[model samples]
Target: MNRKATALDVAKRAGVSRSAVSLVLNGRGDGNVAKESQDRIRLAAQELNYSPNAIALSLRNQRSRIIGILSDEVVVSPFDGNIIGGADDVARSRGFVTVVMDTERDTARDASAIETLLDRQVDGLMYVTVGLKPFEVPQGMLRVPSILANCYDEHPEPQLHHVIPDEVKGGREATEHLLQLGHEDIALLAGAAESPAAPLRVQGYREAHVAAGFEAREDRIFMAGWDIDAGFHGAMKLLDDVSPANRPTAIMCANDRLAIGVALAAGRLGLSIPADLSVMGYDDETRIADTMVPALTTMALPLREIGRAAMTTLLDSIEGNTAEAETTVETMVPCRLVVRESTGPAPTR
Candidate 1:
């Protein structure tokens, strides 16, 4: 096989010095090296397929260039794994690496996992949760440049930056979508009260109603668990033994699993989707939402965006690029509305 290309080869090809190659590749070239030469070095490296030796570079900079990610069940669960994927994407692009440790929802193991990562000399840390909630920031996390994704610090005076989806806006937009489609009477299957995201979504649902000059009926909102069964049962209470005029024109669920349950209930009741009753879901889960019988219209969490934003913040702090590294700040990424066949104009009474 041909010998691997080196920085010297790249420098020669780009007509720059090897030291310039080192500076540019290590991200210290902005002011030290001319922009035009930086471009040439990068292009030459690409053409020659030359990459810097990560181990040697790390030793020289006294940084491991490795980001450690702690997750609450992301590795084992299908939901919210994209958050890590997004974080890794940014890390790789910036010449850094990511190492992840999953607690599998075991809060007791968090401290130990963090200690393990710290022992490994990771440059920074990031904590990601499967859902939006608050947790006490692990003490070890404060010892390094770190950030949170899809979760927040529970401390009275928060100590870390966090990136999360705008769940309240997601819920409001979902309800508004139904209302704009002429669904004046809507039922909400809010997720469990334990999840911080549940109540925020409910608040959004109510806000949309108030904005539309409609009263959000408390009786129609169920703090149902996040599952197919909860969705089915909640929907039955709304549609079963109720007259068409008395039934809600649309049912909004806190998650796609719940939406699946709603569909099952609708099928048993001989109600056709969108024609008789509209259905909406949140999270836009993989395989479930888009593959439902009529497909699903839902609000999508910005999982990847949250991850990317969180990683970017952590790296910025580690590299001394931001002064807010020591300050408490929150970043909220907006959720997207994905329209599908499950939602349409309300049926004429």
Candidate 2:
């Protein structure tokens, strides 16, 4: 194999001194080096495929240019891998690399994992979770600039910055979509209260009803678990043996799996979707949502966006690009609505 190109090769090709090549390639070329020389140096480096040595650069700049990521099963689980993909994209574009460690949702391993990342001399850190929830901030994270993605600090006075999706808005929008379709008697299969996202979404559901000039029926909201069985049971209790006139025209699930259960229940009851009842789901999961028989109409969690925002925030703090005093401790990304075959207008009474 041919030897790798170096700064010296780029300098000779660009007809500039080694110091000039270093200055231009390192982004300090503006006033010190002529614009023409900077352009030539970049073109020569590109042609020569010459890249800076990360180790040497780190030593000279006193920055590792590495971001450490602490994940609670995000790396191993298929559910939220896009968060890390998005974070890596931003990190790579900013001339930084990322190292990820998965704890598989084991909170007990958090401190050790964080300590390991810190030992690697990372310039910054990010903690990502598979879902939206609050956790006790790892004390090791406090030693460096850190951010949280799809999770937040549970402390009364939060220390680290967090980026999360606007779950309440997502819940409200799902309800509003059903309401706009002329469904007033909407049933909610909200996730269990243990997950922070559930209550916020439930709150949004109520907010939508209130804004639409109606009071939501408290009895209709079921704090179901986040699984197909919970959804099936919840729907059965709502629809089985219930008179058509009394049954809800639309059912909104906290997740797509629950929506699947609702659909299964509807099928068993010999009810045609949309024509007999409308269903909505959340999370817009990878293949599950789009490939469903009737394709789920759902609110999508902004997983990738949350990751990108968290990394950006962490990097800004590391590079002194953000004003610490003015920086907010939380960043909330908005969830998106994907319309599909699963939802429709309420049946005419």
Candidate 3:
């Protein structure tokens, strides 16, 4: 077995003392060690494949250089993996590593998950959720530099930072897109009324109509589950009762899944998308949105960006870069509009 190279070996190869190698490698040799000597030490270390002892370095600094991520659910879902990727990418670039623990959305496991991370002596913590909602801060989180991602607290601590999507804007954008296509009579297939995202999106839908100098038909807005079945049922309800002259020309679904449901229902009814009716959706759902029959026009949540921002905020707090006396911080990330083949100009009645 090949023995791991040591600073002593690097120093001998560079013709410098071990102390000199240590100073150079630890970034404390600047202004003390000669530039040529530093260069020689680096070259020797590279040749020997010498690596620093991370544990020893961490102990010396009194920091683990590891960030702990405690999430309500696995961040590896098709709609959420980007959050983990984003956080990991930023942490690596900043010379830190991440440890993730999923609570499986079980409140009973939250305490245990937090304790496990704390035991590891993580430098900071990030409490994340797969969806946007309010969550209670785990006990002891306030004792450490912590941040919230894709979630917030009802009564946030002044220093606590939150990163979340702008649901209202996303909803409005989806509606506005359909309106721009000259669809004056629009229907909304929204999510469950109790969902936080549902009301915000509904507000956006109404705001779009108001901006266009019209009021949305209250009867045309249907609240249901955030699924294809709900969308199908809602779309049928809107189309089945109304005469062709009074029916909506466009439908704005709260999510891509719901929009897919609408599309399926429309197909069964022999309605050609955008020819007989137009459809728009939110939460881009990358895997499903672009692969649909006519594809999908939707608003994309900046999931990865939200993760990056949350990690950045937590690091800033840990480094004392934020205002010391600040009580709370809320960071709203905007969603982007992805135009696809599912939406088009309203057909002339």
Model 3 spans with C-alpha error above 4 angstroms? 1-53, 156-159, 323-328
- Per-residue alpha-carbon lDDT of candidate 2 for residues 183-220, written as tens digits (9 for 90 to 100): 99999999987889999999999999999998999999
Q: Top lDDT: which candidate number?
A: 1
Candidates in order have lDDT scores of 0.93, 0.91, 0.85
TM-score of 2: 0.88
- Report the C-alpha lDDT of model 1 over 1-349, residue by residue, as the tens digit: 9999999999999999999999888766767799999999999999999888899989888999999999999999988999999999988867899999999999999999999999999999999999988978879998998899999998888888889999999999999999999999999999998889999999999999999999999998999999999999999999999999999999999999999999999999999998999999999999999999899999999999988999888887787667643555899999999999999999999
Which of the two candidates, 1 or 3, achieves a greater TM-score against the reference?
1
Arranged by lDDT, best first: 1, 2, 3
- Collision count of model 2: 0
lDDT, model 3, position 150: 87
Stretches of model 1 off by over 4 angstroms after superposition: 1-3, 8-24, 27-43, 323-328
**Candidate 2 lDDT (Cα, 0 to 1):** 0.91
> Global lDDT for candidate 3?
0.85
From the highest TM-score down, the ranking of the candidates is: 1, 2, 3
* Ranking 2 against 3 by lDDT, winner: 2
C-alpha RMSD by candidate, in order:
2.3, 3.8, 5.5
Error of 3 at 161 (Å): 1.4
